[model samples]
Every structure is written in C-alpha cells, then in structure tokens.
Target chain A: MYCVHTTALSHRFSASQQVLKEIELAVPTGSIYGFLGPNGAGKTTTLRLLLGLIKKQQGEILLFDQPLHLHRLQLLRQTGSMIEVPSLYGHLTAKENLLIWQKLYQCPKPHIAEALQIVGLADTGNKRVRQFSLGMKQRLSIATAILHQPALLILDEPTNGLDPYGIIEMRDLLKTLNTQHGITIVISSHLLAEIEKLVTHTGIISAGRIVFQGTLNELVSRQQSESQMILQTANNTEAAQIVKTFVSDVVINAQHISMPLLSKEKIAALHRALVQHKIDVYEMNAIKKELETIFMELINQTKHD
Target chain B: MTNSFTNCLSAEWIKKRRSFSSWLVVVGACFIPLILTIMFLVYPKQILDLHHSGQFWRILQLRSWETMSIILLPMGIVLAVSLITQIEFKNNMWKQLHTAPVPFSSIYFSKLVLILLMLAQLFVLFNIATYVSVWIPALLNRDVPFPLYAINGTDVLKENGAYFIASLPLISLQFAISLQFKNFLVPIGAGLVLVVGGIIAHSWKYVYMLPPAYTALHFGEASGSTKHTDHNLTLWALGYFVVFVIIGYLLYVNRKEKG
Candidate 1:
C-alpha cells in the first residue's frame, strides 16, 4: 500500500523564490524512507507540505490514500510529526505535557506510560522539560510524537543535537518502531551515515528536485567503475607526460597520477613503463567508493549541472 | 455540536490552567478589587481622592459597580486584553491548539468566553467590595442607602436592564481589540488610550466612534428620551465588534501553522 504519496507537489515562497519545484515522491507502507539533502534544499518545507502543516501551492499530498489537508485531523490522528523543532512547552514536566496532549487527542490512556518507556523517558516524566538535556529533550519529543500510536511518523533531524550514545538510542528506537510496530518512518537528514543504517529506501534531493530516488542497492548498482590506473611516482609531472602518450583524460594530483588505461594489457604495459622510468611506487591501489563519498560525488555532479 | 464545543473549551481550559500566564491573570484579576477595597477601608479620607477634593466617605460610598465601571473598569479591560493577546505573543501553545482537530470557532470562542469570564470575576469582586462598604457604614449607624447600592441590582437593573445589556457591546469592543493584537501591551495600551479618547470625544458630539468608556456612561443622564435611539453609539460598538471578530477569525484561520 502507498502510505505516503505526493503528485507534482510544487510550493513556491513567491514568484521569485521557488522553494519546492514540481516533484513526485512515494514511500511505500512499512518502509523506512530516508530523505537526504543539504541545508536550505527544501527538505523541511517538503515535510511541512506532506504533513499539511502548510498549504500546498499546487498538486496533492496523500496519506493512506486520503488528501492530507482536507482530512488533516483524520490524517493527523494516524500520523505524527516533529516538523523543525520539538515545541513542547518548556515549563511543563514531561508527564504534564503528555497528560495535556493526551487529553487533547484523547488517545488511549494506558499507552502513555508505555510510550515513555519506548523512548527511555519514563524515569524523567515528572521533571520539567526545560531542565532536560538536549538529548533528553529530543527523546521526549519522539515520545510525544508516537504517544498516540501513529502509523506514520515524520521526523525532521530527530537525531540533531544528540550525543553519540543518544544518537544510537534514537536509531534503535526508529528501527524498533519500523520493524516491530510496523510504523512507517520518513526521516530527513544530511548525514549519509545516519540514514545509511536504517533507511530501506532513499530519496536524494537537490535544488528542490529529487536527483535520485530508489533503493540503496539500485543506487549502488548504477555506479560504473572508471577504467583508470592510479600511479604513485616520485615525479607525477614526468609520469603524467608518459601516461598521456598512451592514455587520455589524464588526471594529476599532488602524489598520484591517474589516466584511463585502454585495456587490461595496457595496464601491464603502463606498469612496465612506470618501472622503466625509474619512478618509485609507494602505493597503486584501485579506489572503492563508499556511500558518503559517493553521495558527495553525486551531489557535486548535480551542482555542476 | 454543544458537546464538541464544550469539549474543546474544556481542553483549552485545561491546557491554559496549567500555564503560568493564566495564573498571572487570575491573581491580577482578583488583586485589583482587593487593593481598591483595602485602600478605601484603611487610607485617610484625602488619599482616596487623588485627582479631586471629594470627601473620603463619599469616595468610599461610591465604590460600587458604578464607580468601578468608571474608574476601575480599565483594570478589567487590561486584564481581558492581556489574557487574549498574550496567548499568541508568549508561546507556541497557540500553534499546538491551532493544529488540533478542533474547530477554529471553538478555539476562538473559548478564548473569548474565558476573557469574558475573567471580566465577570472582576465585576463580582467589585460587587463584594460595594456590599462591604455599605454594610460597614450601616453598622456604624451612619447615613447610607439600605441594601447596598449595587449598580446592576439597583437603578440599572430596574431601568429595562439597559446598563448590563449596554455593557455587552462594551465587553465585545475590548474583546475585538484584544484579538487584533499579538503584543500583550498593544491592547492594554490601546484600550487605555480609547478610554481617555472617549472622554474627550464626549464633548465633540461625534463620540460614537469611542465605546469602551462612553458605552456605559448613559447612566449619568436621565433615560427620559422616549425613543432611546443611541444608534450611533450602538452602531459604533457593534460595528467594531463585528469587523474585529471577522478580521481576527480570518487572520487566525489563514495563518500558517509555522507562524
């Protein structure tokens, strides 16, 4: 089932400043979809539009096959969100805030204590939120969003301002919600490592457009290996001139010279040529791309385009 | 529909009751009449008449609803104004309520109703002060009217209940002013200015535009005009109330959740 869907959803601040260009995105039911983008790339704006926190300029947003804004209350009853900042009242204790919100939503009363335990905030329930550390505040925020047992949880930078242990705890909570409770999660973050752990699906947005959207494996498979030989030499300048005689698209850097080899036979011939040229080789290993590096590389490619 | 309306109201009440601002309003609302009564009871006769040379006994005698509607009514207005506008200016609680499943009218009307209740409490305190003042004089074997001169229960209630009825629009005018502002000071400051401005406008004949002070001033003049067509004043107060309620509603409904 399509748990979340947007069709040609376009929102512009004004005629001059377009925040979200025409874009279609989908996150299937029970899938943990990670939204990756740079700051000011309209990630939060898109989340707001999705949750009906703001008006959509054009197109439609649907949650569980219902229009978000038209049935916002019904939609919101089953969907929880923490838009930009966790805006729980600072003066109210964690339990007091939960009690007031529970009265507002009239959610099942028995689950409030359980929800607090889920986020590991049950012990701090009576302490005022203002006294909470940043990590505790973030945990309490998650507890609030999911207290009603929403099927879909939209969190924007849920791990922001968290220490390492707090981030780990948050990650575990997200995974548990998705895997055990069947809660679909849409999380937006700039850190690839953060998303790489939990997201089964990924959407990379740049300049208010989705540059890439697919499963992680599909993205990995799309990366083609460059037929390039990296050479380490005492003198890269001489080595580059010699490699230029045999190959094209030569790339030179401080300690290494790289150029595309015509074939496997040419790689052996180049090795012989480099050794014959009296250039000492420290290392000559092929580069394997990680997701973080690949993410930056793809983002840079889009920037140039 | 009534159930839902009351449910929303109760929710708003529960949320705001725990808020510090509501505590401030409650304390401030009760304090005004308490302070005024204490001043009347203890202070030397001359201190009560700071602006005039009236006898202290007369000043204490006049501390009824009529006196409060003239001098201390501004305190009620200030309290109402802050209670309404400060909800928006101080915190994110407005955003929380706005995004809830409740109807916009419920939220708006509940707040309006709460402000009116606060004003009602002030009115009741003034009544109590008046009762005690009159009771003390009678106990001392002095000349005072029997059955303490309560403004709403006395001359005003007998005259077709025009005094309480007329004050409806007066309260409505301040409600509008409070809704229009996001800053807590704007409504209080503006209400004070209108109160002073209304007194000045009374001499200009076109004082209909100012209603906070002038709307309830009809008691001073005899109600002998048979037709009783104070259309201009009624229109001014009602028109301000209607225009403001609409503007406030539209501003609230159209506001983005982020704001």
Candidate 2:
C-alpha cells in the first residue's frame, strides 16, 4: 500500500504566485522516499499538504487510503511529521517535552524512553532545549515525532544545518527506523547526494513540478542514457569514422574520441570492430557526473520544457 | 473526545510553566494588597479610621480596586493572555501544534479554558490576599484592630463575582487579538493604549459602548446616576464576552495557515 498518495495536488500562496502545480506523488509503504528539490521547489508545501498543516486548495490527498480532509486526525495519529525546522520549546527539558507529547499522543510512558534512545537522547537529562546544540535539538525533534511509534514518518529537510557527523547520524537513524523498525519515511532535501544513499525511491521536483519519480536505479538509468563515454586509442582519426558507424553523436578530439554512452554489449561490439580494423584500443572510461549535476540537469530540463 | 481535550489542556498547562503569565497572575493579585499592608503599617490612621467608621469592607473595596478595576487588572489580562497565546508563535510551536492529532476547536478552547482558569485563580488568590493584607497589619500592630465586622460572605461573593464577570469582556477581547497577531507588542500595546483610553473615558455618558469600560463601570465606586447603570454592565460584559469569543473562534478556525 502507498503510505501517501496525492492526485493533481496544487497550491498557490496568492493569485500571482502558484507555488505548487498539479502534482501527483505516490510513496510506497516501508520505503524511504527522498523528495529531492532545490530551495523554493515546493517540497515543503507538498509535505505540509500531506500532513494537513495547510488547508488544501485543490486536488485530493490520501494518506493510507483515507482522504485527508475526512480522516485528518486519524491519519495524523498514524503519521508523524517534522516540517522544516522542527518547532521545539526551548524552555522545557527533553523529558518534560516528551511527557507533554506523550500526554497528547496518549501513548504509554515507556515509548518515551524508546523514542529518546532511538534518537540518541536517552542520557540528555534535564538540560533545557535552549541549552542543546543544533544536532541535539534536531534529534530531540525526531524523538518527538517518533514517540508514538508512528507507522509513517515525514520529515522536511531533516538534515539541514547539520555537521557531517550529525548528517550521518540522522541518515543512520532514519535507516534504522525504516529497516529495523519497519516504518515508512518520506524525507525532503535540497541536495540529491544528501539523501541519495538512504533513499530507495526519489522524486525530483523542479519549479513546483515533479520532473522525475522512480527508484534510484531508474534515476541512474536515466542519467546513463544521457551519459558520455571517452575513448583513447592509437589512431583517433580512424576510430572516429568507425565510432560514427556505431553511435551518431561522435566527437573526435585531440588523441581521443567521444560519443554517447552505449550498452555494455554495444561497447564490446565496438571494441571488436575497432580491434579487427587494427585500431588498438588503449582505454575506455565513462565520464562521471556528480549527482548535483544530474539534479541541475533535471531542473534545467524542466525549465526547457 | 474528552480525553483529547484534557490532553490538549494538559499540554497547554505544561507550556505555561515557562511563560511569564504564570507569575503575572500571582504578582498582579498581590500587588495592591501588598501596598495596602504597607500603607496600613506606615500610616495606621487609615485602618483606625475604618474601624471607627464601621464599614471596613467598603473602604477596602474602594482602595483595593481604585486602580485595579480600570488599569492593572485589564492590562494584566491583556499581557497574560498575550503571553499565553504568543508562546506558540515565539517558539515556532504553532506549526507543530496544528499538526497534532486534534481538531482546531480543541486547541482553541483548551487555551481559552486555561486563560479563564488562570484569571479565576488570580481572583481567588487576590481575594485571599485581600483578607491577609488586613491580617498582616493586625499581626504587626497591636493598636490596629483586626476587622471585627461580620464578614458578609454573600456580599464579598457578589462583589468578586461582579468584578470577575466584568473582566470577561476584556479577557475575550485580548484573547481574540492575541490569537490574530503574531507580534507580542501588538496585543499588549493595543491593550495598554485601550486601558488608558478606558480609564479616561470610564465616566463618559455612553461608557457601555466600550468593552474595556465594563470593569470600571461595574465598580461604581463613585455614587452617581451611573450606579443604576452598573447593575446592567456585568450583563452587557457577558454579552460582549460571548460575542468576542465567537468572533475569535471564527477568526482562529478559519485562518488559512494557522502556524
């Protein structure tokens, strides 16, 4: 079952600025869905709509197969969310804060310890949240979200403003929550590489639109279709003529030949043809593109469209 | 549903521990009584005069409520309600609160109930402190006789009930304003300016037109043609309280983006 499903969900802050267009998102159960976008890409807006924080302007939001407007409280009871910077009362201690939420959630007391321990805040005694470092506060925020052991957890920019170690800890915590505890997660981030490893599914949003949504492998396959390969050989002049027969967009440079990435079998076939023609194959390397480049390319492609 | 409301109220109660409104109630209640005790100590003639006059309760009422009914109590309500409502905005907790598994009405009424309870508690404590103010003077000075007149429990209850009822409109008005504004000063500053205006206009022929004037008008400390009108001011205050609360609830619940 899909944990979250939105059909043609659109929102506009005002008549002039439509922050979210007609968007559809389906996050599978028990999967870490990374909502990838840049700043002002409508990721937070979508998450807020899913959590019923903002009133829905148009379209429908279904959480766990229940309409959000009809079953908001019921769905929210099962779904935990941290939108943007988690709002925490700085004056209260972590335990005191948890106790307040425990009363709200009406969960058993032991769950408080379980959540604290899950977030690595079990030992943070009596220190007011105002005294906590940013990392500690972030973790405590997560603990608040997880206190009732929700079936689905939605976090917006969970790793923003964190050190490397803190980011790693957050990633590991989310991973444990997903795999070990069997919870579904939908996490939003501006950087693709930030959550690329932890996310099993990714939805790349650009300019308030979903540019791509699929598994990580499908995303890589998309990048591979547009990827470039470089060829080094003894005779570049002849290799260009031979490479032109195999791939259309062949560019011959000084001492090397460049062409669109081919399938493994095609590359092998090209190697055989080049060797049979007496053009010694020296080396082959596919040009590596940073994940950020792929992210930008997706966004720019949307703009072009 | 009742359990959810209780939980909401419990959460609100926990939040007040860090709010200044928690202490403002106590301090506001004791302030006048503290000064009265000191006054009776420094100048013993006032209590002695009251003892000779035989109407100690009436004199105490005038002295105790002279500034309170028009100024401090109304302004205290404004600040206390403002502080209580602004806690969520100041700490950015409204977004979290709005996302909780409860209805908007639950959050709205839970806060209103807490503020009303605090106001009621303040009145109860102030009433106790008013009696203590006289006791402290009696304990300190042997010459100053303790109030010997039979304490008319009904009269005291009626007077306090009147004052509390009179303050309702002010409380509801401030709550409505606090719920709408995110800035701390907007509600309190508006309340401060309005209290001053209410005090200045408390004697106006049409004082009933102003909601803030209800508290002062209900006191009727000065004997005038207005004393007859004071009887109906609490009724009007209750009416205004209901009206303002409805408006506040509508504004709060209909808000597009609550957080």
Candidate 3:
C-alpha cells in the first residue's frame, strides 16, 4: 500500500505566481522517498500540503488509503514531521522540548528518553536549546518527531546546516528508522548526493511539477540507456572519422570522441577500425550518468521545454 | 478529549516555564505598586493631606487605578500578549505544532487559556503589591494614622475585578494581532498607538467601541463622580471579548505556515 499519494495537486500563492502545478506523488510504504527539487521548486510547498501545514487549493491527497483533507488529524497522528528548520523553543532544554511533545502526543514518558538516545542526544542534559549547536538542534527535532513512534516520517532537508559527520549520522538515523522501526519516510533535499545514498524512491520536482518519480534503481536504469562511450585517441580527427562509420551520432572534441553505447560488439568493431587506421586508441570506457547528472539534465530539459 | 486538552495545557505550561517573557508579566504587575510606594515615601505631605481629609484609600485607589487602567494595564496587555504569541513566531513553532497530532482547537485555545491565566496572575499580584505599598508607609510612619478602614479589601477587589473584565477585550484583540505579526515590535507598536488613541479619545461616546478604551471607561466608572458600576460598559467588554476571541481563533486555525 502507498503511504502517500497526491493527484493533480496544484497551488498558487497569487494570481500571477503559481508555485505547484499538477504535481503527483506515490510513496510506497516502508520506502525512503526522496522529494527532490531545487530551491523554490515547490518541494517545501508540497510537503506542507501533505502535512496540512498549508491549505491545499486544488487536488486530492490520500495518506494510508484515507483522504488527507478528511482525515488530517487522524493521518497526522501516525505521521511525524520536521519542516525546514527545527521548530524548537530556544529557552527550553532539549529534554524539556521533548517532554512538551511527549505530553501533546500522550506517549509514554520513557519514549522521550528512547528518542533522545536514538538521535545521540541523550546526554544533552539541561542544556538550553539556544546553546545547542545547529546539529544538536536538528537531532532534537528528529527525536521529537519520532518520540510518538509515527508510522510515517516527513522531514524537509533534515541534513541542512549539518557538518559532514552530522550528515552521515542523519542518513544513518533515517535508514534505521525505515529498516529497523518500519517507518516510512518522505525526505526532501536539494542536494542529490546527500539523498542518493539513502533514498529508495525518488520524485524529482521542477518548477513546482513532478518531472520524475519512481524507484532509485528505475531512474538509474532509465538513464543508463543514454550512457555514452568515451574514446581518447592520439589522433582525434582520424579517430572521429574511424569511429563515425561504426557508430551513429559520433561527437568529437579536441581530445576525445564520444558516442552512445549501442552494443558491446560495437566497441570491438570500433577498436579494430581505429587500429587499421593507425589512430591509436588510448582509452575506451562507458560513463554511466550519475543521479546528480540525470537530475540536472531533467531540470534543464524542463526549463528548455 | 479532556485528556488532550489537559496535555495541551501541560505542553504550553512547559513552553512557558523559565520563559523570560512570562516573568516579565510578574515584573510589570509589581511595577505600579513599587512606583506608588516610592511616591508615598518621597511626598509624605501630599499623602498626609489626603489622609487628613479621610480619603487616603480612595485617592490611592484612584491614583493606582488610573495609572494601571490608563497606562500600565493596556501596555502590559500588549507586552504580555506579544511575548506569549512571539514564543511560537520567534521559534517558528506554529507549523510544527499545527502538523502534530494535537487538534488545532487545542493548540489555539491552550495558548488563549494560558495568556488568560497569566493575565489573571498578574492582576492578583498587582492587587497584593498595591496593598503592600500602602502597608509599608503605614508601618514606617508611626505618627501618621494608618487609614486601614479607608483601604477596604472588598472595594479593592471589586475595582480590580472590574479592571480585569474590562481588559479582556484588549487582551483578545492584542492576542490576535500578536499572532498575526511575526516581528515583536509590529504588534506592540500597533497596540501602543491604539492605546494612546483610546485614552485620548475616551471622551467621545463612540470611543467605547474601541476595545483598548474599555480600561479608560472602567476608570471613569471608578471615580466618585460617576456611578460605581456601568452595566453598558460591562456588556460592551463582554461583547468585544466574545467577538474578538472567535475571530482570533478562526484566523489562527486558518493561518498558513509557508516555511
């Protein structure tokens, strides 16, 4: 069953500016769904709508088979969220802040301790939140989100403003929440590399629309079809002529010739042609596009269209 | 549902604990009495003259009530409500609180109830301090007869009770404004301007329509020349409280958190 599903979701702040347009999302249960978008791409807007933080102007949203608009509080009871910055009372201690949520959720008192331990903040004793470093506050927010033992966790840029170690810790914490706790997570991030390692499902949004949404492996496999073979030769002009006969759409620069990888045998045939032409081939390798590259290509393609 | 309400209140109480702004209300409540004590100490002859006329408590009540109703109470309401609502705005806690499992009604009303309780505490503190202000001078000046009979406890309670009721409309109005604006100074500045305008325009009959002016109108009723109680002003205060509270709750529940 899908944890979250939105159909033809669109939002506009004003008559002149449309933030989200015909956005659709399907997050499978027990999968870490990465809501990927650049800044100002309506990823935050969509997340807000999902959590009922913003009013949905148009569309249908279903969370756990129940309509979100109809069952917002019921659905929210099973979902925990941290939007943008960690919403913490600076004057209160980390433990005090957790206690507030603990009371609101009516969870057992010990769950607060458990959550703090999970976020590695169990030792943050009596330290006011304002005194905490940004990473500490982020962890405290995650602890608050999970203290209720939610089935779905919605985190917006959870690793933002974290150091390298903090990012690694956040990634591991999210993975543990999904795999160990059996919690579904929908995390949004602008940095593809930050999310690529953790996310199993991805929905790439551009200009307030979902440009791509599927499993990470599905995305990689789809982009793999466009993988290119790079050939570095001693003689570039002769190499281009020799490789053009065997491969269509051969692209050559000053140092190398590049073309789509059509088949495994095509490389062998091209090598034989280059040897016969005395155009010495120095290197030949297939370069599969990375997720970051694919994300940029998708955004750029949307812009051009 | 009752459990949820209690839990919500407990959460709000936790947020308010150790909060500098909440303590500011206590400080503000005591400020007028401190000023009154200093006035009695510095201007003994002036106080003695009122005592000679056998109207010391009446004059003290008038002075204290005027200062509180015209100046301190309205400004205190502005500051207290601003601080209470600013907790959420300053920390950007509105979205987090709204998205939580707690109902929006609980969130909104819990804050409203907390502000009311804080204001009530301030009223009680201010009254106690006023009595202490009088007691200090009486103890120090052995020769000057203590006007114990003049400072009737029931009268003080009645006056303060009236002041509290009169201030409710302003509290509700300011609470809404504070929640609407994120900047600390915006709601405060607007409140101060309205208060000054309310005081200056209190002579006009239509000025009673202004919620902040209800304090000034209550002060008018307390002065001996006017009747001790004005039923019309009381009804207006109640009307404004109900209307503003409903409006405020609706606005808060409908408020969108873009971040």
Candidate 4:
C-alpha cells in the first residue's frame, strides 16, 4: 500500500501565478521516498499538502489508504513531519521542546530520552534550543517527529544546512528509522545527490509537476541507457566509421570516437569491427550518467517542453 | 480529545513559564499598582484627603481602577496577548503544531484560555497590591485612618470582577490580531492605535461598540450612582468576546504560513 498518494493536486497563489499544477505522488509503504526538485519547484508545497498543513485547492490525497482531508487528525496521528527549518521553541531546552510534542501525542516520558539518544543529542542536557547549533536543532526537530514512533515520517529538506558529518548522520538515522522501525519516510531535497544514497524510490518534480516517479533502480537503468562510451583509437576516423554501424550518434575527434553505450554486446561488436578494420584501439571507457545529471535532464526537458 | 486539551494546556504553561515575554506582561500588569503605591507613599496628604469626606477604600479603588482602565489594562492586554501568541509566531511553530495529531481548535483554545487566565491573575494581583499600598501607609502613619473594616470587601471584589469582565472583549480582539500578525510590533501598534482612537471616540454614542473603549465606559460607570454594576456592558463584552474568538479561530484555520 502507498503511504501517501496524491492525484490532480494543484495550488495557486494568485490568478496569474500557479505554485503547484496537477502534481501526483505515489510513496510506497516501508520505503524511503525522496521528493526531488529544484528550488521553488513546489517540493515543500507538495509536502505541506501531504501533511495537511495547507488546504488543498484541487486534489485527492490518500494517506495509509485513507483520504487525508476526511481523516486528517486520525491520519496525522500515525504520521510525523518536520517542514522547512526545524520549528522549535527557542526559550525552552531541547528536551522541553520534545516534551511539548510528547505530551501532545501522548507518548510516554521515556520516549523523549530515547528519541534524544537516537538523534545523538542525549548529551545535550539542560541546553536551551536557542543556544544549539543549526545541525543540533535539526536533529532535535527529527527527534520530536520520531518521538511518537509514527508509521510515516515526512521531512522536508531534513539535511538542509547540515555539515557533511551531520548529513551522514541524518542519512544513517533515516535509514535506521526506515529499516529497524518499519517507518515510511518521505524526504524532500533540492539536490538529487544529497538523498540519492538514502532513498529507495524517488519522485522528481519540475515546475510543480512530477516528471518522474519510480524505484531508484528504474531511474538508474534509465540513466544507464543514456550513458556514453568513449573509445580512444589510433585512427579515430576509421574507428568512428566502424562504430557508427553498431551505435547511433557516434562522434569522432582527433584520436577518439564517442557513442551512446547501447549495450555490452554492441560494444563487443564495435571492438571486433575496429580490430578487423585494423584500427588500433588504445582505450575504451563507459561513463554512466549520474542521478544528478538525469535529474537535471528531466527538469530541463520539462522547461523546454 | 480531552487528553489533548489537557496536554495543550500543559504545553502552553511550560512555554509561558520559560518565556521572557510572559514575565514582561506580568511586570506590565504591576506597573499601575506600583505607581499608585508610590503616589500614596510620597503624596499622602494630596492623595488621601479625609477632609473631603471621601471613603479611603473607595478613593483607592477608584484611583487604581481609573489608572488601569485608562491605559494600563488595555496596554497590558495588548502586550500580554502579543507575547503569548509570539511564542508560536517567533519560533515559526504554527506549521509544526498544526500538523501534529492534536486538533487545531485545542491549540487555539488552550492559548486563549491561558491568556484569559493570565489576565485574571493580573487583575487579582493588582487588587492585592493596591490594597497593600493603602494598608502599609496606614500602618506606618498612625494619623491616617485606615478604613480596613470600613471598606466593603464584596464591593471591591465585585468592582474588580466587573473590570475583568469588561476587559475580555479587548483581550479577545488583541489576541486575534496578535495571532494573525507574526511581527510583534504590528499587533502592538494596532492595539496602541485602537486604545488611543477608542479613548478619543468615547464621546460618540457608538463608541461603546469599540473594544478598547469598553474598559473606559465600564469604569466610567464606577464614578456615578451605578457603582460598577453595568450588566448591559458585561453582556455586550461577552458577546464581543465570543465573536472575536470565532473570528480568530476561523482566521487561524485558514491562514497559510509563508514558506
């Protein structure tokens, strides 16, 4: 079952300006779904809509097989979210801030300490939130969200403003939350590279619309199909002529012929043809496309279309 | 749901206790009584004129209520409401709080109830401080007649109770505005303008319809033969309180936080 599903979701700030347009999301249960988009591309807006923080202008949102608007309180009871910058009471201590949500959620008192420990903030005793570092505040925010052991966790840009180590720690914590606790996490990030290693599935959004949504392996396979193979030969012109028959869109330079890496068999055929043609191949390299590149290509395609 | 409301109230109390603004509002409430105490101590002859045949308790109550109604109570409500709502706004915690399992009504209701409770506490404290201000001087100076027994305790409680009831409309109005505006100064500036404008418009027949002017009108009755008993004004205040609360809740439910 999908942890969250939205169909025909749209939002507008004004008559002429549309913020989100017909956005659809399918986040599977027990999987870490990364909501990726450029800045101001409505990732946070989509998250807000899913969390019922903002009223939907036009959409059907389902959370845990229940309509979100009809059962917001009941649905939200099993969900936890931290949107944008971690919203914390500055005057209260980190533990005090968590206690507020703990009481609100009716979580046990020991859960606070457990959450603090999970976030690596267990040692921050009696420290006011205002005095904490940005990363520390982010962890505390995550702790508050996870304190009740919700089934679904929605975090928008959870690693935003974190140091490298902080990002790694957050990634690990999210993984543990998903793996050990069986929580479905929907995290959003502007950078695909930031959450690529952590998310099992992804929904790439551009211009308020989802351009791609599927498992990470599907995205990787798609990227692989668009990958390039570089062949450096003693005679580039002859190698290009022999390679063009096997691979379309082959480009020739002074000593190299480049073409799309269609398949391993095609590369082997090109190698045999190059050898038969007496073209001395010095090096052959396959450069797989990065997820970030695929993300940019998807967004750019939306812009042009 | 009952548990949620209780939890919300407890959370609000914790936030209020840790907040400096809460202490600021408490200090704001004590200002008029403190000034009155000083006035009585320094200018006893000028303030306590037994020769004029006025009851000391009556004069003390009048002076305290007059000062509080004129500027202190309205300003205190404005500041207190702003401070209470600022706890959420300053931290940008509304979105987080809204997305929590608890009902938005519980959050808003608990906050409004807490603000009212704070205002009530201040009213009681002001009355005690004002009484002490009079009793202390009378105790120190044997010449001044202390009308401790002569003063009707029930009348004092009734008058102060009336003042608190009359101020509810203003509190509700300010609380609504404070919740709508995230900036602390905007609500405060609007509140100041309302108070000044209400006082100036008090001569108009419909001026009593204004929330800030309700305090002045209710206390204005105290100087006359009515003696702090304005059932119509209290009813109107209650009506205004309900209307403002509904409006505030509606605005809160519909408001979109800036991303």
TM-score of chain B of each: 0.67, 0.94, 0.90, 0.89
Report the C-alpha lDDT of model 3 over A120-189, residue by residue, as the tens digit: 9999888899999999899999999999999999999999999999999899999999999999999999
Candidate 4 per-residue lDDT, tens place, A87-153, comes to 9999989888988888888888999999999999999888889999999999999999999999999
Candidate lDDT scores, in order, read 0.67, 0.88, 0.87, 0.85
RMSD of each: 6.3, 2.2, 3.5, 3.0
Q: Which 10 consecutive positions of candidate 3 chain A have the poorest summed lDDT?
A: A261-270
RMSD, model 2, all Cα superposed?
2.2
Question: Which number leads on DockQ?
Answer: 2
- The whole-model C-alpha lDDT of candidate 4 against the native structure comes to 0.85
Select the stronger candidate by TM-score from 1 and 2.
Answer: 2
- C-alpha RMSD (angstroms) for model 1: 6.3
Residue B117 C-alpha lDDT in model 2: 90
Please report, as a residue range, the 10-residue window in candidate 4 chain A with the lowest summed lDDT.
Answer: A239-248
Off by over 4 Å in 1: A220-284, B1-4, B18-21, B43-62, B75-80, B83-85, B125-196, B199-202, B214-240, B256-258
DockQ, all models: 0.28, 0.74, 0.64, 0.59
Report the number of the highest-TM-score candidate. 2
DockQ of 3: 0.64
lDDT of 1 at B5: 64
RMSD of 3: 3.5
The Cα error of candidate 1 at residue A123, in Å, is: 3.6
TM-score of chain A of each: 0.81, 0.94, 0.90, 0.93
When candidate 1 is compared with the true two-chain complex, its DockQ is 0.28
Q: Candidate 1 lDDT (Cα, whole model)?
A: 0.67
- Superposed by TM-score, candidate 4 places the C-alpha of residue A302 at a distance from the truth, in angstroms, of 0.3
Q: What is candidate 3's TM-score against the reference?
A: 0.89
**lDDT of each residue in B150-235, candidate 3, tens digit only:** 45778878887888889999999998888889899999999999899898876775776788888878887778544423348888
Error of 1 at A122 (Å): 2.8
